[model samples]
Target: MNTINTYRKKRFWAAILVVQILLFFIFSKLSIAISMFERFFEIQKEIHQLLFSWIPFSFGDMLYLLLGIYILYSIITFFKKKTRNASLFKILILVNIFYFSYQIFWGMLYFQKPIVEKLPEKEITLEKKKELALKYLEKCKQTRAVVMEDKYGVFQISDVHKIKTEILSQQAKLPSFISSKKAAEINSLKPSLFDGVMSFTGILGYYNPFTSEAQYNTQLPSSYIPFTLAHESSHQLGFAREQEANFIGYLTGIQSSNPELKYSAEYFTLKSLLNSIVYEDEKFVENVISDFSSGMKRDWAYEKQFAAKHQGFLNAFFSFTNNLFLKSNQQEGSVTYSYFIDLLIRYEN
Candidate 1:
C-alpha cells in the first residue's frame, strides 16, 4: 500500500510539472501580465536583499553548491536502491519545485516587451556599423589613455566598489521611454564561488533570480569585469534577454563618470561592432585593430590569451548548451551579436 501511494504521489507531481510547463507557454503570450512582474520586482528585490545582501560571501553560490550535491546524491541513491521508485519520485518532486520556482522568480520576465520595440527605427547598414566601429575605436583609445592600468600596462579597475555603486545610481537615470522598472539601491553583487569553473566555460557573469544577486567571475580579465558586472546587474533589474541585458549594460557603463567603467563599456562596444563588420570588411577591421592604443592593445591581448587558455571540449559543450538555452528564451544565442548591434545602432542614431 505504501508503494502504491508513493507511485500516486509521483504521478501527481509529474502532472503538476506538465501543467506548469503549459502555463509558461500561456504566460509567454501575455505581455501585459508579464510587464506587471516589474511592479513586484521591488518587493522581490527587497526580500532577497534583506536575506542575502548582508552576507559577505555569495549566498546564491552556496545554494547552487548544495543543490548540486543533492542532485548527485539522489542519482547515486536511485542506482543503489533495489526499489528505485521512491528515489525517482523524489527526483520528480525536486525538478517540479525548481521549475515552478524559476518561472515565478525570473522566467516570466522573459515574456516582457522586447527592448528593440522601444528603440527608434533605423536601417542598420554595414557601412554604418563600420563607421561606428571606427568611432568607438577612437573613443576607446582616448578613454583607455585615462584609465588606471596594472604593472602589465593593461587596464585595471582602481575601485570596483565605486563601479558597483555607480551602476545602481545609473539605473535610475535610464531613459523612461525604455525602462519603467524601479531601480532599487541594493549592493547584492558578489564574486562567483565557481570562478574557476566559469573561467573554463566562458561565462563571465550571471544573475541569481532566486536571490536577486549579480555574481561575476572574478577570474576574468580586468577589462571584462566592469561591463560584465553591469550586464549581470541589468539582469537583476528584470531584463531577461541576453541582448537586452547587454544593451542596458552598455547604457549604464557609458553613462557613468568613472573612467574605468566608461572605457570598458566603450571597448566592448568597439569590439562588438568590429565583430559584426569583420566578415564584411576584413581590411577595415585590420585597420581599426591597428589603431588601438598600446594599453588597449595589451588588454586585448590578455583577453585573447584567457580565451586561448580555456578553449577545450568543456567550453564547446557549455557554449552549445548556453546557445540552446538562449534560443529557447527568444534570443539569438552567444555567437550572434546582430541583435545587440542592432540595438546599439538604433540607439546611436
Candidate 2:
C-alpha cells in the first residue's frame, strides 16, 4: 500500500511537469520558431507534400508500430519481478501527458488558418452576388458534380461497394502504407453526434495539415459533416494547402452518389462564392439568389440554423487561426479560407 501511494504521487507530479514543459514550448519556443520561419513555411509545406507522396507509408502504420512497442514495454514491465502498481500508474500518467502535449504542440504549430485580409463590405449588390453563385453552380452541375448533402438527419455513403476505387484513386490517393483497417475506419464513420465537432485545442478537426492522420469532432451538424470530413480527409491524404484540400474535397464529394454528401459540397462551394462576391460584383450576387433551387433554399435555412447554434466558438477560433496562418505565411484577411479564390480562378479559367 505504501509503495502504491508513493508511486502514485511521483507519477502525478511527473505528469504535471510534462504538461508544463509542453506549454512552455508552445507559448515560447514555438512562437519564436514560427516567427523565424514565417517566410519559409511554404517551403516546409511543399516539402511535406513531397514527403507524404513519396514516403509510401501512412502515419497510421507508424502509429500501429509505436503502439505495438508501447504494449511490449507494458508487457515487459508486467513480467518484471520488482514491478509494482506504482510503475503502472506512472506509465499511464506519462502516456496521457505525452498524448495531450503532442496535440497542443501540433495545434499551435501546423494547423492551417484562413486568410486575414479585410473583406470588402457593401461592395457587391445582392443581385450580382447571387448571379456569380448561380454561374458557379451551373459549372458545378455541368461537371456532373453531386453537391453535398443536407443537414438535420440523413443517410451517408460508407460502403466501399457503393463507391468506385478508381475515382478515389484519381481524386486524392492515399499512401500504400495506409492500412486497409485505417481506410475502413475512415469509411465506417457514420453521421453521429461526434461529426464536425470543434475541439478545445482550437482544432476544427484532426488533420493539423502538417501531421499524421486527420480526424474531425464527429459531433457537427449533418450538412457540414461531409465537407468537413472531406476537408480533413484531404489533409490526411497529404494535401496541406487549405485551398487544395477544399477544392479536392468539393470535387470528390460531388463525384459521390450520396445525396447528403453531394449537397454539403455544393453548399460550401456556393457559400464560398457568395462570401467572395460580397466584395466583388453585384450582378453576380443577384443572379445566384434568383436561380437557386428550392432544395438549396431549404438547405441554406438549415445551414443558418446550424450556424446560429454553434458558430460562436468555432467561428472565432477559425478567425484567430486564419490570422495566424496569413501572418505566418506572408499572405493577406486570413487567407486560410481564401484558397477558394484560387479555386474560383482555376475553375473560371
TM-scores for the candidates: 0.98, 0.49
Candidate 2 stretches with Cα past 4 Å from truth are 1-132, 139-204, 208-211, 257-260, 282-287, 313-318, 329-337
Model 1 TM: 0.98
lDDT of 1 by residue, 74-133 (tens): 888899766588789999989998998888888888888888999889999998998898
Candidate 2's residue-wise lDDT over 1-349, tens digit each? 8786877677687777677667645643455654444334434444544555344334433554576788788778867757756556656665666655453434333433322121222333345445556765774444323433335323233432233232243344432322111121223212222244453323445453333444455455455666777776555443444665676677667656555556567677877877776566766566676665655555556656655777566678777877776565334445344556545444433
Q: CA lDDT, every prediction?
A: 0.89, 0.52
Query: Pick by TM-score: which candidate is best?
Result: 1
Q: Clashing pairs in model 1?
A: none
Candidate No. with top lDDT: 1
